[model samples]
Target: MSKAIMDLTELLERVENDRELIRDLLLIFKEEFPRHLQALRDAVDSMDGEKVAAEAHTMKGMLSTLSATSAASAAARLEQLGRNRKVCEFQEAYAAFENISKKLLLQLDTCMAEVGG
Candidate 1:
């Protein structure tokens, strides 16, 4: 099997191995991520570059917290496109971000299942 969606070792270390805290944060991520993703999709579809940047920035922060580096970078790309008001470039960036997000969510779900989260 592949590795866990996120390697929480560092996170746990930072929290001194507080398992409950880790669980809580993961649960919050699970709850919030889908909504954030949907908002990003909506912003992209509407060609609202500013909104896309805002949503992507938010996603970047959340993904960074989980150490999902590639996914976070995908979000960052979208954020940059939005910041630059690159409407023509939005489609490809949005596609990449969306694809990465789907994979990331699958990884998250697998990890959550393993942990009985």
Candidate 2:
């Protein structure tokens, strides 16, 4: 089973009762994740399937912290393709990432709402 995705209050509690961790985490999410996302986007846009796969693999590895199951799986698939030089799977990988990211973000939004921010 997957780890339960955390609500914002739980996240805040874990940071030694300081909600500042939420802000810090949000900053990291915004600053670092978009770069990784853009890397995937650019790699995909350029049709450099290997780069796409590599970027996806990197993303998948890091995204595990969020316990976003589909995203992790998508990244794994992309990594396999990139490592194997099998570029044709890019579409499936992209689709997986897209679906997973949406679901995970929605869950996060709900968590945030529950916690008052």
Candidate 3:
């Protein structure tokens, strides 16, 4: 199989190898991700740079915590674009973030399954 998206080994280490906590964290992320995504879409659509920055920042932290480096990087890009008020770049940046976010979600699901969440 291809390399996993999130570094589960690293994540487990960070969580002190608590599979149950990992499962709970993944569940919370799954629950919150959609809402966060919607907020990001709204921020992008409205060209609200500050809002986008806030949303992207939140996502970046979450993704980083999960060891999803690629998605976290995508989110960091969005956060930077928003902070720089690059409205013209929002569409492309958001698209990239969205694509990576989808993959991250799938990876998270796989992780959840592996952890028996």
* Number of the top lDDT candidate: 3
Write the residue-wise lDDT of candidate 1 on 1-117 in tens digits. Answer: 654446666666777877676677778988998899889889888999999999999999988887778788989999999998898888899899888777777776665554456
lDDT of 3: 0.91
If ranked by TM-score, best first, what sequence of candidates would result? Answer: 3, 1, 2
TM-score of each: 0.84, 0.66, 0.94
Worst 10 residues of 3 by lDDT: 1-10
Better of 1 and 2 by TM-score: 1
Q: Global CA lDDT of candidate 1, please?
A: 0.82
lDDT of each: 0.82, 0.65, 0.91
**How high is the lDDT of residue 74 in model 1?**
89
How does candidate 3 fare on TM-score? 0.94
lDDT of 3 by residue, 32-108 (tens): 99999999999999999999999999999999988889889999999999999999999899999998788777788
Off by over 4 Å in 1: 1-5, 113-116
Greater lDDT among 1 and 2 belongs to 1
Model 2 lDDT tens row, 1-117 = 533343444455555655545655555664677788778877866768679777887777656644455567777887777777676767667777766666665566555455455
